[model samples]
Target: MSNTQKINSTITHASINKCAIPYIRYKLVKKPPEKYIKSLQLDLFSQFVTNDKSEVSNTVEIWESIPKYFLTPAQVKKLRTDTGHADPYEWNYSEKGGNFTVRIQPALIKQGNNKYQAFFPGITEELVEEALKKILTIQNHGIHDVNKVETWVRFSLRMVLKELASRGRDRNINQIKHAIEVMSSCVITLSKEKKEIWKGSILQDLVTVGREEYLADTDAQHIGRLPLFISHAINQLEYRQFNYDRLMSCDEQLTRLIYKKLINRYRHANLINNYHFMYSDLKSTGLLQQNREIDNRKKVLSALNELKEKNIIANYETDERKESRAITDVKYIIYPSNEFISEQKAANKRNSDSDKHSIDPNLISVNKS
Candidate 1:
């Protein structure tokens, strides 16, 4: 069959039973509550519908259903001492929104008898995670074991390096390896109303094979496991999809973060309307870290200009509030580019197509064959 025909067939079959395991479970439930049944049906349908990575495209899937506070901002950086060695101290990042506070602590790793080091999740870690997600989507059909809390993913070190290269960044195997280690070691803790909802490392159970020379070779394969928290998050239906190529084309980390944040904010809004954000609010998200207001404004302007050059934003205007001739605050009004609007519309159509083809749960039956 042609690739298009094959994809259509897969989608049709998936829509019929929504995968065998979930359908079987649904049948086993006798008189399940309405809420429970709805959740189950949604979960079952989501397994096949939400992830459209199989369709030929340059876009990559990113999990956006999880609370944004759980993510460490681009501004977070690794600490270094005067001697140029990593600072062996623990630091905490906490953000309060409404009644909940999200906190992240980079767990200290023992280096020797008396030395310890802490690593924060930054751009490199983010790149590694994105590459992994892309690999999973391409090879595993973006399927994760719902029965297991942690899912094992096998990938070549060189594969990750190549993925990074495609995303407009080139790095050696050691750099990728170190980023994976940091992701595995860093601890993210979330609490709502003083009750801890979840806490875990971004990745865990990492294993690398091959001798030193072989491992250094570009073709060597390695494996890493996603933690329970991440695994559960992947099973959720809601997510954000973006053009991987466009995102990686960004030369600066700040610009990339700003683009992602704006895309998420603009998902449901009309493209004709202007969107605005306070400079202080952007700072709260960890995008701007300059100590002075003027410096921060410059950083924002530079990033916005880059976004405009990339055609992600059509244009942006900055409004400054002054008190006694001193700038008190700044607001940025962003105009979405046609390219970005088209991408959003395409994503919406894909989602709508998935929903349109969805079959009722009562009509689905297990295919024992």
Candidate 2:
């Protein structure tokens, strides 16, 4: 069978009876109930920053200490041995950003007395990952507290900042604030089959500014709440856990984002050692700015090389089609890493324990037949 046929056949034969484990339980915090959790009636605008000197210092300290515990071999082993009960639901639902495209060009947008700037961020990967995590966090909460269709959630600003790798630098908080503002203001035009399906922004409102005196440098520590529209999209998100440890090993920002994007696109499928993507699509989604195609191609090649060197991925080949003495199309063939396999093994073991001999829902299982 051809590659396309094989992919289609695999997808058709796939029967997922449970959702993939969300996060490594060993890696997550086991915190108690919060007065300000996901709530519809919660005043997100009231979630503000503080003006205390110690708050800023503490935030900085947390940010600095956060990366010390990325995905580790022990953590992977722990997740593999974990036998938590996962909901028996396939993660085949459509992802929000799957078919959409964002032109990371910087531009200013106006919204009723607020002028927001939308730009391609330097920390694009971090923001994207945090956004996905937030979606999961809120949706998981919605499953219990409220309906998951479009529920508003109140999340602590410090929590999100830490997840976003906030270094408590003077500029880190502002950077995150601007990132959210850009997401809220940027225009998203969704299309299918070369036709426009919907046009709107990803975020409905800005972070609620609270009146807390957390730090001297920062005046108001803002708590975040998702608007219904954004939550609606997130509610429909179906995703797999990528190798966070291997991903964090890469020091480059652009490389990390591209790698995550690749995983997000292909993780739903049962890809063993190989995956491919069109050059144009990679350039459109992976590259930061809408720059020259050749330059973008170079950057993509460089990033992929870096990943290969770091052993995140291996054995990658690119197909460059030259027409009229110009490169027209490119196809990338890359293999999964050893770390990726370890993660799949963990998922498979968990599935066996939870659903009693069911197939892995993440579609990342090894074909051990």
Candidate 3:
């Protein structure tokens, strides 16, 4: 169509299909041998940035430059009447007042590390603080651009693949082939460079680390493979590539099938409590009936267990068998270490002397010692 198209066409569709596509493919790349391409339901070109208005105009120029030699102008005349070929060429870019808006989702543009101080370690903490103030604000609220929302996520995905490819090729040209062998997926097509640059599937490979589950299902779309969410899918397939309101029904006999060995090897020695137990106590303070004492025992025990797991209490004695309530160890001792003890004693002595010094001095000092 144009230089851009011609240049992009140089990209191996097979490669893109293998890696980045499965992670973002709209559909049509799934296959066997465990490698298939899938689209992540993104409009890749919509978010493409242009240098200026001239560049957008240049796209049409690129399309106009198609040679008339092997691909003669007659082909275009014939394609005008063709159905399948026309569909691929007909793109609606002018719908939004001359330019397609590309806005990335707030959650999608998230960097690998939200609060990380490393990797970008060379950057100063003060600078990091300011950058984060702005970055996190938009990240939480979503970016405001139509095309950005539409295409930025896929663009990020594209960046990931490109980076991976650049890394491998710079090191060993031969490694390119091996890399392709491993990354060659039938699902989606990507350039060899795209596969090599994209270290792993973006949603799964993890451009950087994050605290929560990286590929959450909120924006995920299904392509076959259960909920083949971004949780992870290999580019192994690129180019070569719920629930409903259930009707009420009677319960049926079900079979218990065990794929692996049955019994639990690790017995439930104990059920240690977590901080949530204490939080529950505070939270349920007013949420219960007048018979509070009835539930107090259970609540206290739950909190005690939680504190114990956290190593807040140190004396580890065996649980004594109990019959009648003999005032079970309700008291817990959290002893300070030697330094802490010394500091505390010093502080106490200082306070005691200060109190003594406060007594009226003139009344007792007249002996002239």
lDDT of 2: 0.39
On residues 97-194, what C-alpha lDDT tens digit does candidate 2 reach at each position? Answer: 33322222222434344644224323542444344344334333222122322333334445556554532222265555555555544443333333
lDDT against the true structure, each candidate: 0.54, 0.39, 0.20
User: Which has the higher TM-score value, candidate number 1 or candidate number 3?
Assistant: 1
Clashes of 2: 17
Ranking by TM-score: 1, 2, 3
In lDDT terms, which candidate is top? 1
Instruction: Give the Å error, residue 198, model 3.
Output: 74
Ordered list by lDDT, greatest first: 1, 2, 3
Q: Report the candidate with higher TM-score, 1 versus 2.
A: 1
Instruction: Write the number of the candidate with greater lDDT, choosing between 1 and 3.
Output: 1
Root-mean-square deviation of every model: 11.2, 16.5, 30.3
- Badly placed stretches (over 4 Å) of model 1 are 1-102, 107-116, 141-143, 147-152, 210-218, 227-233, 268-271, 357-369
Q: Which tens-of-lDDT digit does each residue in 232-348 have in candidate 3?
A: 111111110000000001010000000000001111112242111122222222222225543644444443343344332222222323349653323222222233233234334
